[model samples]
Target chain A: MQIPAPFEYVRASSVDNALALLDRHGPESRVVAGGHSLLPMMKLRLARPDWLIDINDLFELDYLLVDTVPNNGRVLRIGAMTRHTTLLESDDIKRLFPIVIDAERVIADPIVRNRGTIGGSLCQADPAEDLSTVCHVLEGVAVVRGPAGERMLSMAEFHRGPYETAVAQNELLIEVRVPIRDDSGSAYEKVERRIGDWAVAAAGASVTLAADGTISHVAVGLTAVGLDRNVTEVEAVLVGQAPTEQLFVEAGRLTSLACDPLADQRGPVDYKRHLADELTRRVLRAACRRAAASISDITI
Target chain B: MQISMTINGTFVTHEVEPRVLLVHFIRDDLRLTGTHWGCDTTNCGTCVVLMDGQPVKSCTVLAAMVDGHTITTVEGLANGATLDPVQQGFMEEHGLQCGFCTPGMMLTARALLDHNPHPEPLQIREAISGQICRCTGYATIVRSIQWAAEHPAGAAPETTTSESTEQEVHA
Candidate 1:
């Protein structure tokens, strides 16, 4: 019979209303979307906020838009209230970034996905959160709205640590922006103890191939291995290199050496590092293959 | 706080604490005991109920959050004395052993079939992956969903007795 402590609940009718409520409630209030992560923590007495402002009715924040105005380049804008199930079923998202689909499939389960929002997942900032890793690898930018105004921050700046984010007490994360690249593909690989358990170790990779078969851009992000962002050292090694098995192996070695994993029931440090290396290699290989296929599709 | 929503096709309003979970609201307040509560954590699927025709874990949802939404519990699956196709499918395919997970499983099956009329076996498995059925090993549960998909209009009257016999054999 788990239950949360007594609190005040208020529903915000619109985005401005939500922001106003947040401003009025001050630091003691927390905005809840989906409530999958927050409610569980509440039940455990881990997160006992004085006020919970429900933003589920802000339908204006539930959108998926692809903008190609050329001035801002091509970018995918996902509203903060977008649910995990919506992301899983979006064909546009599947065609643009399959890594999201891969991670969403293994996030929680169909039932949790129904109400879990992408904004809530990012805001929760669990060190092992899969969407954070996927967004990090893809270089996602978060658009946050506060009482003063709106500001955009990269994934690195947005995520301060586990359960912490740049979203202030009076601010709301409004949207996530991912830059779409031509001739590029992304993939995510995870190893978990069970079907819907948190990842023992997960890796996400996005690669862009040049016309001459060289890697123009590459990034690898890991989850549950104590790393906050993508593996910049591995990305540096593969950026200008050719798409070859040898390069992937070298990248894998660098990943294994660079990550700082902890020992727990999931695995010992060594095993987690091994998974980081192997999953990194797997995602990189898949990303390169998909990148090549994208190039071919463009040429055809 | 005061909240009103449509539950089992009936409009209901209740005053509940802000921290009350939707599952508690349904079972304890509304007295819809068919929706079982298990694993206070969100990991278990026994607390699943349809929110606006989509399966959501009610244990994690605040009652106030579903203010204007429509909820479908296992009790709503049947029409008067007639059983839903999913309920019939369960009885025909012997989907339950202890019956603790049946209500949630049937509601999920109904939601899946509503969205996808004919899902593959793999799809059915994936759809119910969040739920844990400690008794039936999930094979019969998958078969039960398949049975529902085949008999969308419910089982014929003549087949009821034979299906009961088959269910008895499995039990």
Candidate 2:
């Protein structure tokens, strides 16, 4: 039977209480959101923290809010404790960012979805993790709260490496902020070995088209291919160009070269590189199609 | 640490080590052996139990985390003498072969039917996707859940357990 090593457990009553507990417990303490990732690691003796501060009772952090900034369009703010099931069932999330729905649908099975939280998924930061790639493509900003104050980190800044994040020993990731664009649409495409397995190779794209059918803004992010950041080279090639098969082909070529994947159980480097190129193109095409549909909705 | 929670409509409290998983707590401590423990890595759904009416892998959840919550194990599915629709459905449809995966499957089916009374075949498959049933190939299991949906109130309780109850009366 697998079991975690004995540790001290404390249930934090509120966000402030959680932060205080984290601050008090110091580096040896870890705040568990959903415990899906942490508990598994604990059982394996991979993550043996001295103290586990349970943040499951912090109901204040469980929310999804759409705030309209005076100048910066609408921003979707997801509380860190929001569960995967809640995200999957949210119509607002479905209507605003279908890419999240696409990613969540394939994140895990419905049962695991009940207990896993977005905050925990992001913090786990396994290189092949789908949500980190999705957040990267969406240009999400991680709102982190520490003893000093609150600070926001970009996806690139938040994710330092596999199984590492910017959330400090005494800090908590409070929210993820994604700016909502007017004529924008995003999509995530992934190929996994099984139903709930991590992606073999996946790509997510967010595209915004100008009134004249030219791409105004675009970001492409990849997963499981050893890329910490999105493919800016692909964005440079597609931005200001009309959505075309030729442009997507060029973007795909750039993506295949951009990612650095190692041979593992999922696939060899060549196969994954091929997936990087192909999934990139598929997501780009799908995002562009959805963007065009959004434009049509606005016009209608 | 000390933890208290409602299990199967009964309020229970116990002192457990922080490392004790909810599955072990239920089975080893509470002796609710119906909730099977399999695949400690959370891949298998045999350890599934309803946490506040949602199916969660009990193997991954810490006992302390559920200190103030309500848990429903397979033993809780039937109300007194009457079998739950899902239990009756399993009996009628022959959903189990080795019965290793039945308890979790039934609890999940019960939760699904509570949320969505009439789930499509595809929905049922998706709902139970995390669970692995090597014995019946999931065909009979799916049919079993459909039977539960069809008979939400459950047909008159008729099972070996009921017969044993009658035997006790005769004795």
Candidate 3:
């Protein structure tokens, strides 16, 4: 029978109300979206906040839209409160970013997905979190709002460390923006012990091929292997190169060498490194194939 | 804090600590013990209840968060002197051996059937993947859900022991 320590609960009526409450409560306050991740941590005494501001009623923040910026580019904007079930069911997400659908299918069971939110997953910042890797590969931007107004931060800046994020105590993550690219496709591959278990090692790849079958841009990110972000060195190896088996093999080798995996019950450090390499190759192949298909779809 | 919500179609309110989980609030406060408490962590789906017609693990939800929401527990599954089709299906298919995991399983099946009138066996299995039945009677459970799907208009509330035994022998 686990129970969280006593706390005062307040329901925020709107985004403004939530930020004001956070400002009033100061650093001891925590905002709960789905409560799937936060409540469990509270029960274990790992996170003991004196005040819990429930933002479940902030329906204004629950949206999924694709907007075209004046010159920056077209971007997919997902509200922070959007649940996993919504993401898994969205045809737009499936067609535009199959990597999200692939990872959401195995993130947790359907029951958990019904309540878990995209923002909650990001803020938790668990080393094994799949969305982090997906966002890293896609170059996600987090829009945070506070008393001082809004500021956008890249995924690299948003993630501080394990269980830490750039969201200040007086701030709330309002939305996440991912730039949509043409002639690009993304895929995520993971190796877990069981059906709903966390990944032992997961890899995500996004590839954009030029008109002549050369790689214009490519990025690879890994999960549960202690890699903070995508492997820029591997991306450099693929950029401007032809999509060949030899290039993929070299990229895999470089990925395995660059990642820092720790040994635990899941597998040995060396085994995880090997998985990082293998999964990277697998996702890159899938992504490149999808990229080619997208190109053909456009021409047709 | 004082929280009020509709449970089993009845409006109920109680003063509960913010730390109290919806599972305990249902079982202890409301005395609706049908919603079992298992693996206090969200791993087990034994404490699942329908929140606004969607299945959610009650153990992970705080009582205060469910304020003004509609909650349907196992007690609300059937009308007076009648059983829900899922209940009848369970009895006919012998879906339970221990009965501890039955309430949550039935609620999950009910929600699934509400959305998808006729779900395939694979869909049914995927819907209940979060729940852990220590009895390991998933085969019968899946069959029971399938039976309910086949008889959407509702079936006889009860089946005699001899009839079930005969069906079991044939099975």
Candidate 4:
């Protein structure tokens, strides 16, 4: 097997050392986490780095912290290096973000999940990834560390375009923070061509039911349908109206309207837009059902 | 970069290019013909090897990244003349026809059995998900793993249990 490009290998024991290596190598070095995304790209000759700073050994970047919190407080802190399998098997993820867990369960099977890191997935910004769309719906923030310091960027602002991210060449994503919901309902659904292949379309919905059985807050993020995955403003339609199939159909239409899927070899633009509407409808219905189940009070 | 790693129970250090994948080092330089390469991508587990006793795709790994690590390839599975239990099980159960997927299947099975000695059918299926076998169907491959699970001592120290996992790496 011929590796695509020549690179200087440097295994850093800690985050600081990795940063130092990146600083020293600058644009020539590629920081490999799980290499689930990078290695494949390298093999295809898309990216050719002369230096690789292997940072997967940085154990500190693999912690999953979960706790009860007040409004605007930290609910969950997931280290970037945590694998998809960990997310699938995590109790905290199951209790807080069942959609994330559910989505992860179907992520490229068990072996890919075992090696695919959350940081790499997020950083890759694959439009079809369920977790990326899930993060967008949950208003997730990526905490990145670089030579200068660390900074947090929201998912919406972090992703610049297709297969692009705001992460600096020298920066390393250290953590991704997702707000935990005690009673809110969130769900993710993906349509795929194969068991281990990337998704054709994925949609995530997070809805908070009010005491009056109406929607308090609603966010919908749709992926694998646009130039870049995006979260549409579905709150206006969801706030007071009943989450009926008819309303979701309208929401799906509007969501599809918000998308700009370019025609690719896999599908035509019209077909992808149709998928956006259908997937949006399915995921919204699923989310509505889950949210309806979480309605504690019958005040309204 | 010059890399040093123990492959097949023997220690050998060699200077290699930085772009040389661990699979290339094992197959070309080290001359271990047993570790086959099907895809040269992580998707195919044909290049799978035990890096510090953990299953990893050698095709995606840089040889220098595994410096000083003890790697167990398919060639390392047998104890000299005696075949490993997993290998013998594959033969006895007729797990393979062309035998191209045998090495990858064995490594995948060995990794799974190491963690969960008694794996369910679903677990066995999941263990070999990384490997892509186009020959003889997966039924026999899965049965061979189950056979090994039943008869643990079909082959010597079995080669699977003698892994030198003194320390753990996150990768």
Best by DockQ: 1
lDDT of 2 at A65: 91
Name the docking class for model 4: acceptable
What lDDT would each prediction earn against the true structure? 0.91, 0.90, 0.90, 0.79
Output the worst ten-in-a-row residue range by lDDT, candidate 3 chain A: A291-300
Tens digits of per-residue lDDT, candidate 4, B90-125, equal 987999988887887898788788788899998898
How much of the true contact map at the interface does candidate 1 reproduce, as a fraction? 0.94
Residue A260 error, candidate 2, Å: 0.4
lDDT of 4 by residue, A73-106 (tens): 8668889999897898899887778789768866
lDDT tens digits by residue: candidate 1, A1-300: 899999999999998999999989888898999998889889999989999999999999999999864444789999999999999999888988999999999998888888889999999999989999999999989999988999889999999988889999999999999999988989998999999999999999999989987899999999999999889998778988888888889999999988899999999999999999999999999999988888764321
In terms of docking quality, model 1 is: medium
All candidates: TM-score of chain A: 0.97, 0.97, 0.97, 0.93
- Interface RMS deviation of candidate 4: 2.0
Runs of candidate 2 with Cα error greater than 4 angstroms are A70-72, A297-300, B157-171
**Per-residue lDDT of A245 in model 1:** 86
Residue-by-residue lDDT tens digits, candidate 1, B110-160? 999989989999999999999999999999999999998887667655487
lDDT of 3 by residue, A172-236 (tens): 99999988998998999999997778999999999998998889999899999999888998988
* Residue-level lDDT for B170 in candidate 2: 20
Q: Each predicted complex: what DockQ?
A: 0.80, 0.79, 0.75, 0.46
Is model 2 an incorrect, acceptable, medium or high docking prediction? medium
Alpha carbon deviation, residue A252, candidate 1 (Å): 0.6
Q: How far does residue A135 in candidate 2 sit from its true spot (Å)? A: 0.7
Model 3 - which docking category? Answer: medium
* lDDT, residue A133, candidate 1: 95
